[model samples]
Target chain A: MPTFADRLAEAVRQKGPLCVGIDPRWESLPKAIRDPLRDELPEERAAIGYFEFGRKVLELVRPFSGVVKPQAAFFEQIGPNGMEMLQLLLREARLLGFVTVLDAKRGDIASTATAYADAAFAGCTVDGDSFPVWDADALTVNPYLGRDAVEPFLTAAKKADRGTFVLVRTSNPGAGLFQDLVCNGQPVYRHVAAEVANWNAPTRGACGLGDVGAVVGATHPKELAELRAAMPDVWLLVPGYGAQGGTAADVKVAYRPDGLGAIVNSSRGVTFPFHPDDPDWEAKIVAAAQKAAAELKP
Target chain B: MPTFADRLAEAVRQKGPLCVGIDPRWESLPKAIRDPLRDELPEERAAIGYFEFGRKVLELVRPFSGVVKPQAAFFEQIGPNGMEMLQLLLREARLLGFVTVLDAKRGDIASTATAYADAAFAGCTVDGDSFPVWDADALTVNPYLGRDAVEPFLTAAKKADRGTFVLVRTSNPGAGLFQDLVCNGQPVYRHVAAEVANWNAPTRGACGLGDVGAVVGATHPKELAELRAAMPDVWLLVPGYGAQGGTAADVKVAYRPDGLGAIVNSSRGVTFPFHPDDPDWEAKIVAAAQKAAAELKP
Candidate 1:
């Protein structure tokens, strides 16, 4: 099996580093999609609507992007039915030849973290029989729980030839509450960045990157450049592009000279470009994806 | 509706501070429970076994503990079927008159955070209809994303008369990697603890404790004592008892003079006391819960 780093590298090389995020909102979905599901049960309707729309989005954006990230929170909002849809959508994205990243931001310690990682990659084992769960190419994790906690996810991912993105510098306005605190003459995020660099070292692939990556928001271009320099061989999953006030130029610092080190994610900007009532929502998604792909070319 | 703080205070007063953590693993489940589900599909079998085992554990431990926390990662390992079982299990736990805490450790920013919070508390809303998702009394949150990320959860919980427990000094040994960093003459966790205290102030209930709580590990009794002094009005959910090697005496510092400030958690210690092949597993579980309840009494 190809290492997760090489798979991601090939995807970015073919698709120009644009990762279209699938963050479905019932209120933001096109009227045509929502109107038809009005008579079904609330969760059922939302699940069906999200799955149908997501499946369409996959098809529409496939020409412009090679990676699709489905935010777990949005699908989780609708409950079990929604989770079922999320599972199906992930499988669909994989079948469509897109590298799927389940952006769950999950974190914990020991066996608990292993459980979440298994669900994201290896699936469940019952009576020696294995069943696939999310089976995504990668998952997004939070690094607050420290070494032992984050190590479980990395171990599980390596066993399955998958990848993980650790949160270092988030894009939210108040993200500096703890991340920016100066410790030992360096900020907390820099420490986290240093750890990520160490973790990514042993897993370096032929693409000059590793299976363990760091999430550095595009909203902070300075930090992005710093982190890029700090973790030269680590892949970067950059959010905060487009809809979150980050421009193409701002995220330019994330890429290496080879254009293989970063993948810029645009969730609402590319996926929900159309108003809920827009009749041409599919075309709008296609156009937005095309624009993002062109603008994000490293 | 009574505020979550008051409700929790009432429960602790009635049943002491033992919070039973339901973290089911297929390999750890009793042979009797596992044998019956052998013919079902892997995920289905695991989900069914977890739900059945969880329901039994709830009934068994109800007389001993008023608060029951269901860890989301274990259930999620079984995929959507496991999540469905989790929802049913939460409903069952609530119906049995236990204060349910969903130990998801979720964190994100803006609407994404709201989506997770809404699922944990207010349920999902489609059009004008609302449907309950997890419906736990409180949900565990990771505060690494800072103010905006944590506030959405607080806001959602407040709207539903629910509560949240933020990770402060976690019980894991490697937790000090980032949480113990000294910044501005104090460790990072102390800053998080101060923020938790501030967040808990406005929502103080009649019992003097507030809806926003902090998770302080029992293993670090010294820090637990210090945090208890720092956040007088905030409730503490203390994990790392028993199986994690934290003695009852260690967690005693988490309490206030009135003994209403802390709820100590025991997962594998209380739930998986008996070996899988042990036919007397039920009795072992009962004895463990009974002993833990008595030992943990404030």
Candidate 2:
């Protein structure tokens, strides 16, 4: 099996840098998807709707994007059954050859961190028998708890030949509250980026990128470019490209000359481009994903 | 129902501030718990073992503690089945009159953040019908994403009459990697602590503490005291009480003069004091909880 970095690089080469995010919202889901499950229990209705919509979105976006990220929060809001739905969607996404990144943004301390990592990558072992959980190719990790918290995820990922993207400069407008605090001479996000670069140093794959990546938002073009120069060997997972007000031109600087250094993500802009009442929602999704792929092509 | 702050204040008043953390590990479970489920599939065995052990811990610690924190990572490691077990444990803990804190350390951007917050409190609404997910009385949130990210949690928690504990200064040895950087003449964590104070201001209850709280580790006694002074009106959820090397005396300063400001969490020290082979595991747990409760009483 290829390293996570190589697999991601190959994905970009085959289908451009577009990574469609499957962030389904119950209210935002097409009526067509929601109406069929109306008679079931609320949890069941939402879970099945999310799964069906996610599966359809996966099929529709397959031609335009080689990587898909399923946001874990939405499914989790529907309870345990929703988590089961998320598991099924992830399995289907993998079976369809998409490099799935579980966007759970998990972080903890020591052995606790190891538990979350094992769930995301290697699966759990019970009395010597192993069972896969999320089993994502990569996972989004929060870096707030510092080195010990983040290292477990990196170690687990490395052991499983998986990957992790650490949050650097997030796209949210309020992100600067703590992330931009000038620590020493540089902003805090820069410090996090430096650490990410250090973490990515030893795991470089044949494609010149490592399993450790940095999530630098497209909303921060200047900082994104600065981060690109600072971590030349790190793969950048650029979110906020479309719905969050980041344009293609804004994210173009995130990529290396070979065009394998970045994978731009578009969630609502690609998956929920139409209103819930729209009859042709599936077509709308296909068109949106196609447009995004074209615009984000490196 | 009273506000989350008042509820916590009442708990502390009745049973002191000892918050027993239910972090179940398969290998750490007593043979009695694991042996019964050995013939089941790996996921089932792990999930059932966690559920049974967690239920037992709740019953055993009921007299010594009024609060229980279920670490989501440990249960999540067992997959969706484990999540269901976590849900059951939370329900049982709540029913047993223990104030439940789901220590997921969840954080994200905008609606995504809202999605996570809703799962923690207020449940999810589908076609006007709401369904509870974790439904924890409180949740542990990561503050790295800044203002907008943390506010949704506070909002949802407030609406549901629940609570939140934002990570300010963690207990890990390498927590200072970013948390202790000199930002604007103060450490980064103090900045986070100040913000927590601000967010906690409007939510103050009769106890003079607020629903928005800060997580300050017992390991850093000096910083814990500093944060205690910094956020006088905010509740504190202190971890690293034992096993992680923070003595009872180290956490003494975390509480206010009135003894209503902090809830000290002890995971392994209270719940896993005995080896898996020990038939007296339950008694060890009771003794540990009793000792911890007696030492930590405000």
Candidate 3:
């Protein structure tokens, strides 16, 4: 099996490093998609509409993108049945040869962290042929509790040849309130950037990049450049490119000169373009996403 | 509706601030409990055993404790069915008048954070009378993504009268690696501690305590005292008191003179006491927990 780094490198090389986000926002979907969530029983809503929409998303994005980042909260909001559907969607994506990054953003103490790593990466197998099809090639992790909290995910990723993207800097308006807070006159995010580089030291891939990565929001262009420079050997999962006011130019700082170090993500901008408007939403979205990906190409 | 601080205060007053953690270690259970997990199909091993063991645990401790900290990762590791069961168990514990602290430790950016808050406090209800019962009065949050990551929880918590415990000084050995790293000469956790105080400023309860809380591992006694002083208005969820090698004396720093500021947690120390050599596990374990509670009481 190709390591996640090798697979990501190959995909980025083939598809221009654009990673679409699958966030099935009920309010933003077309009438055809939104009706079921609004009208059906909760369980039926998850099993029928949610499942179909997620599957359609997988099918739609598979032909064009290098990877798909599925925001776990959107699926989890519908409860366990929604998660079951997520597993199905992940299996389908994997079968189609698309990398799935489970954007769970999970962080906890050691034991709990180990359990989450096990849950997300190694799904239980049922009958001789029935296996739990987990949808992620890598997971998004929070680095709050320090190195110990992150070590379990790193250990699991190493064992399974998977990957992790630790949140070093986010794109939200209030992100700076804490992340940019100066301690000893330097921003806290810089400290996190250094830690991300340190954690990935042991897991360097054949391309000299580590399986561990950092999530540096495109919203902070200057910080992205600084963080990129700080962690040269780490892969970057850059979010907040389109809807969050981050332009293609802003995201470019996240990439290396070779355009191989970063995977830029756009969630609501691509997944839910039809909210409160657009007569031909799906077509409009597909076109918009393709355009966005093109504009973002190195 | 009683505010989280008020409810927590009432529970503590009634139950002596003893917070029991429901961590179902499959290997430590009785033969009868272990039998089901061992004999069941691999797919059934975790979920069925989890629900059964979880229900038993709820029944056993419901009468004695003020709060139950159900480790979300344990149930989550068993898959969707386990999550569903965890929700059911949480509902059962609530009916028994025990506050539930779903130890999910989930943290993320804007919209994602809103979804998690909804899932934990104000659960989605398909029908008016029959809503999915969110089994937690409080939640453990990760503060890595800045204040924005935690703001959604605080918003929902204020509205719902729930509470959140942000990770501060942890019990793990490697906690100091990053959390203790000095930025401007003070440890990173000190910065987080001040934020906890800031976020809790407006939601002060009748007891003059705020719903926003901090998770200060009891193992770091001196740091706990410093953190306690830093966030005077915030409630403290002190873990590592028993199984993780923290003593009751070490945890006392988390409490106020009025005994209104903290809840000490003991997971493995109280739950899985029958480790082959220990005689009279249940009685001994119960006695130890009671003793620890008494020792910490003001």
- Best candidate according to lDDT: 1
Q: Residue by residue across B1-298, what tens digits does model 3's lDDT show? A: 8889889999898887778888875555555655645667665675676677667666665545788898988777667777777888888888888888988888887878887887788865443422353637998998877787889989988777799999888888778866876766678889888888989899898988989999999888999999888898889998888878888778888888888798988887767767634556556556656665667676
Best by DockQ: 1
Q: What is the C-alpha lDDT of each candidate?
A: 0.95, 0.94, 0.79
User: TM-score: which is higher, 1 or 3?
Assistant: 1
Query: Chain A TM-score of model 3 versus the true structure?
Result: 0.92
Off by over 4 Å in 1: none
Tens-digit lDDT string for candidate 2 (A43-148): 8899999999999999999999999999999888888998999999999999999999999999999999999999999999887788889999999999999999
The Cα error of candidate 2 at residue B193, in Å, is 0.6
* TM-score per candidate, chains pooled: 0.99, 0.99, 0.94
* Interface RMSD values, listed in order for every candidate: 0.5, 0.7, 3.1
Higher-ranked by DockQ: 1 or 3: 1
Which regions of candidate 3 deviate over 4 angstroms?
Answer: A36-39, A124-135, A276-279, B37-39, B125-130, B133-135, B276-285
lDDT, candidate 2, B1-298, per-residue tens: 8999999999999999999999999999999898878788888888889999999999999999999999999998989999999999999999999999999999999999999999999999998998789989999999999999998999899889999999999999999999999987999999999899999999999999999999999999999999999999999999999999999999999999998899999999999999999999999999999999999976
TM-score of chain A of 2: 0.99
lDDT of 3 by residue, A17-103 (tens): 788887775555566765546666765564556567667766665556879888888777767777777777777778888888998
| Global local distance difference test of model 2 | 0.94
Q: How many residue pairs clash in each candidate?
A: 0, 0, 4
Q: Candidate 1 — which pairs collide? A: none
